[model samples]
Target: MKTDSQLQQDVMAELRWEPAVHATQIGVEVEDGVVTLAGEVSSHVEKWNAERAAQRVNGIRGLAVELEVKLGALDKRTDVDIAQSARNILSWTGSLPEDAVKVLVEQGWLTLSGEVEWQFQREDAAESLRSLPGLTGVSNQIGIKPSPSATVVKAEIEATLRRSAAADAKAIGVEVHGTSVTLTGAVHSWAERDSATRSAWGSPGVRKVIDKMSLVY
Candidate 1:
């Protein structure tokens, strides 16, 4: 286990190492393995990058982001412009179905809502718009259309975990309730936890994934 001060230092160092993030603009505070990030960032992408960089550090039990996005003069745009840009970008994205996702913008924040057949498509829709100028944040309300039985979804996720090198299949437990899958167990690292969740999302008809797995350092 790492002391709170050590964890904070490590997170700050990791933020500096990430090229996309402006390390100086962000403040990292750690208390009992929980990290709180507070400060201001120029763009939504930079803010997202900073969060990921902090998560890369070991011994983080939880994270709370208080960072605010303040767009520069050159990056600022009206809500209409942001919405149009979001629509155009989504249209050009080959992975997403045409008009499958609806975009609404308010005060530079973009919200996407609709239904897609696969989890990847839902994710791709939101990712495609993260780089839009003047965007403060994104709310991905897109849902997945369920198609498989709960038993089959559970089986597929278990098989995927077993096949993945990053995750320990035997140590993880999978449970399915309707279209939602719950993962409970202990993972060796953040990478393993991500792998386990990804495996669950890969199964067809999985609308939601609940991660109850703990990271064991």
Candidate 2:
């Protein structure tokens, strides 16, 4: 196990290594394995990248982001412009069904709400808008169209876990209730926990994934 100081240093170093993040503008603080990131970033993409860089470090139990996005003068745009850009991008995205997702913009924040057949489509809609200039934040309310029975969902998640190299299938427990899946167990690292959760979301009918898994570090 790494000490809190060592963990903080590693996270800072990882932030520096990520090209998309401005490491000097971010502050990393670790306490009992939980990392808190505080600072201001120029873009929402930079803020997102900073968080991902911190999560890549080992021995992290939890993460709290206090970073704020402060758009530069050149990056700022009107809400109408932002909304038009979001619509154009969503329409051009081949992974999403035509007109399946609706977009709303308020004060530079974009909100997407609709239904999609797969979780990846829902994620792709939001991810494609992250780098948009003048965008402050995104609210991804796109829901999954439920399919498959509970038994099949559970079995597919278990099979995915077993096949994933990052996760230990035996160490995790899966429970399915309708379209919702609950994961309960202990994972050795954040990567394993993320892998297991992603597997649960990949199931055909899964709508919500409740992660009750703890990181052992």
Candidate 3:
């Protein structure tokens, strides 16, 4: 006693696909929306794709992820192989020091650990890994340290920000305790807060910049 349209809507909601997508692949039946998918995709990842795609169809009371995982299409690389490939990309790019950063991939989730000479490099490492497929999230614990020539870097960051925020250099407190810079002060607007942080990074000697600026609205 189920309607065709009702079943279709259920599967679609489960996946949160676009309206246009629902309109296209909605295959309805008298009993339920029996979604039958066919294809030859690369790996087990795509095997899940078939199920997930059918799942988002709306009224899928039952699903058949019967699609075969075409191993021939895949390189037969283990998860560790993909993880090493991901690490190599980050290391070869010198996003962080080699061995200083560790990459671990499990079921497509990329985890990174390491120390870098700059906040930029730490961030770069995390970003590069995020681009890999099947990433759930990144645990970026990369520590940053000031370069030997960070004084110039700090000065440059400050100069660039001063163009926007009317920051009294004295009002902005800067404390360099290791590889991180603690910024304890206040800025007028959100824009000023961002500008101030950018200035801090421009300074070559700084590593990470933490701001304690509360918006005064």
RMSD of each: 0.8, 0.9, 13.0
RMSD in Å for model 1: 0.8
Candidate 2 collision pairs: none
True-structure Cα RMSD, model 2: 0.9
lDDT of each: 0.92, 0.92, 0.56
Q: Is 1 or 3 the stronger prediction by TM-score? A: 1
Q: Which whole-number lDDT from 0 to 100 does residue 64 have in model 1?
A: 98
Best by lDDT: 2
lDDT of 3 by residue, 115-203 (tens): 66766777678667644554444567766654554455545555665564446455566655554666777655445555677667655
Residue 101, candidate 3: alpha-carbon lDDT: 83
In model 3, the number of clashes is 20
Report the lDDT tens digits of candidate 1 across residue range 33-121: 99999999999999999989988887899999999999889989999999988999999999988889999999999999999999999
- Write the number of the candidate with greater lDDT, choosing between 1 and 2: 2
Question: What's the ranking of the predictions by lDDT, best on top?
Answer: 2, 1, 3
lDDT, candidate 1, equals 0.92
Highest TM-score among the candidates is held by which one? Answer: 1
